[model samples]
Target chain A: MPLQNIKVIAFDADDTLWVNETFFRKAEEDFCALLEGYMPKEEANKLLFDMEIGNLPLYGYGIKPFTLSLIEAAIVVSKGTMPIELVQKLIDIGKKMLEAPVELIDGIEITLKELSKKYRLVMATKGDLLDQERKLIKSGLEKYFHHIEIVSDKTEKHYKKLVKHLDIQENEFLMVGNSLKSDILPVLNIGAHAFHIPFHTTWAHEMIYEEINHPNFKSFTKASDLLQIL
Target chain B: MPLQNIKVIAFDADDTLWVNETFFRKAEEDFCALLEGYMPKEEANKLLFDMEIGNLPLYGYGIKPFTLSLIEAAIVVSKGTMPIELVQKLIDIGKKMLEAPVELIDGIEITLKELSKKYRLVMATKGDLLDQERKLIKSGLEKYFHHIEIVSDKTEKHYKKLVKHLDIQENEFLMVGNSLKSDILPVLNIGAHAFHIPFHTTWAHEMIYEEINHPNFKSFTKASDLLQIL
Candidate 1:
């Protein structure tokens, strides 16, 4: 309830302060059009999602595998009807995803500007080399983080690694984000505090359990709405 | 262009037929507030991003790990200030995502109904088990799809698997939807016809390359606006 003894605060990227997944969705419709007559619209999406799920272990989080996956899907769907020129364009579409600009959520800048005054912020996320860095730079929020880790996994080991690298005790750190899995759970497991914030577009992969009875778990309903509370 | 030899049509899920990402976004803002005095807002987001990136491998796609990621970020940001009472509520958000009824995109059902008359329809998407199924069932789109496959990856192997399973050829299929990686590129890669219909709320991973110069690769700028082309 009362803000007391707060030391280091961690934030989640993607859907937290800015919009991320929604942009990826824009490409989905474009992708579906690539295979109109061969398979059903939903079948094609299933195929791509399967590739993403399959490649997650090998590729982690990035656009390259997704591109390759699309390429692979195109090949399967082509089945002899797709033209070379058209296939080339489809491949290009996959590559273009790498360069998408970051768009922050509304009211985010003002809320962050206000919250920055009271907390020592850090960015803890999982993504590829260029994608995450590009987002940070594009979002104009990179300067705020004292530490940035683009990890392949977010297991307990990962959290412990960050704690060790930052030299911040669990008790002295707090986590925040739209994801309970990466944003809240591990940090809480380590005896740190956590805040759960539900987002609108909960990705199928990023969604996780919420915390209610932990020694240090909290939640809010809005961005700037919480500024006065803090 | 004129419809030629088009028979069965496939649709990609996520952004093609409905709006999905808006939910997670609203949740993230709530997650960020737990880090009042510990960290700045930007720092908190970066940390949350780190955590999400970490969870990509472990959870892959679904609401489970995503929710967990948020909870973890909350803990890390709190640094001990996040009250435990909010933890359960945070986890509940994940369940809420599943429980939330499917809200179709503007004119999705109408478009699908119209398109079904001229082509065979089915759904092809890659996502978490319960999440996609729940969405499909609640959206009432399940009846339209003659074949539905919720696979782990969308690769050549999987497409071929679907093709063999569904007894369809690439030339006889057309994939439509809002994802480039899942719907466009992969279907194109397989020598099949593909369509690119762009959606506004695409996911980051699903967005891919775009090409306006393909023979078999067709696209519609708007979802329900497809009728205008004919």
Candidate 2:
């Protein structure tokens, strides 16, 4: 059956609507390079990931927390001997990430514009508020969204609460995003329709090794592909 | 007359419901001490404040952004001569701030418990999403609030949007907080009632030098005072 009853269509802002994870990947490469004198590239990446996972409860997501984790990893790996200059360089990397231009994924504008005409479009993404708001404004896609929810995490409870707030029945809401862990599974778990548009580069944290098979779930390789599905 | 018609009563989380600004103040003192070798206390504070205001558009608010600003200020003030130990110390300061316990204001529990019986209680505060969520969970006051909004900033437009979301008319909503700039004036400007219970120490950014005179506005010296007014 077609998703004909869906009245609200929400899009994830990061990699789904725009280029995001790629920047993180790039930053990680530079971050690993900065700490090579203290540890191997593989060891540095593992330590940084461990720090990020451990800090999730307190620091949440975004470049700020990532930067902090990098510093912490540096200190731990280098046994507190990491140079001050290197720490300053890490801070600069974070600043550069924050200042990175908002590059919308291909066909996002056309897809959003088309989808907005038929449904109540909303932007649901998790990250630092100012950074996300800045990106939204830069994307110039705010006009298409009826509501924007910058949540801390995308848990099953959070999605349920969001659907309740939007006042739409679960079956009548659809979510589109790049991360199956964050964007797809939670909505699917709630019995809501979800579309996964895989990006070229996915963060290890966002990777889902398990297979997903749900009646309401769909996958697309491109944003424009959503046109045919919806 | 009485605020008997208020259907929804929202409180600002930081400073108003609990001790928040004091932590920031303490952190600022510690931050200044960390950089004392590089610049005078007064000069360091002025430069840090300037960096904070300048970085506001990029970093927004909260300890993460504040921490980043501190690093930037340190680099500029020290002319890149800042020691690695100092940078490490600054990171520690931020971690300490984040790990600080959520200390509720006097009589907040009773006030919220009593008020929750008669009105829909909500938490409306601006800051990092993760930090705010952690504080709310730690506060043990989450059960009292029906909804929690961790917004980017509290502007008149944002409040209007919130009231609309709650499906409450402006006259039937009341906002209580410590900052007149954030919690009081904006609500009053939108034809809503506001209560100001000032904290002992206020951030310079939150200070409102102008006089406020509104029929729907009230001020109190204690949280318990709210019980009598309501």
DockQ for each candidate? 0.01, 0.61
Off-target runs (Cα >4 Å) in candidate 1 are: A1-3, A79-81, A209-213, B1-230
- The sequence of per-residue lDDT tens digits that candidate 1 reaches over residues B68-160 is 566567666775345444454565566566566677877878788787777778777665533565577778887776644554457666566
After superposing the true interface residues, what Cα RMSD does each candidate give? 21.7, 2.0
* Each candidate's fnat: 0.00, 0.61
In candidate 2, the residue pairs with backbone N, CA or C atoms under 3 Å apart (3 or more residues apart, or in different chains) clash, namely: none
- Candidate 2 lDDT tens digits, A81-158: 876777778888888999999998999999999889999999998877778878898999989998788778999999
Cα shift from native, residue B62, model 1 (Å) = 28
Can you write out model 2's per-residue Cα lDDT over B1-230, one digit (the tens) per residue?
Answer: 64777999999989888898888888788878888888898898899999999988777889988887887788887888876677778877888899999999999999999999888999998878778888889999989998788778899988999898789899999999989999999999999999999999999988879888889999999888999977
Could you tell me the lDDT of residue B84 within candidate 2?
Answer: 68
- Candidate 1, TM-score of its B chain: 0.84
Each model's lDDT: 0.66, 0.88
Please give the range of 10 consecutive residues that has the lowest summed lDDT in model 2 chain A.
A79-88
Look at candidate 1 and tell me the lDDT of residue B198.
Answer: 79
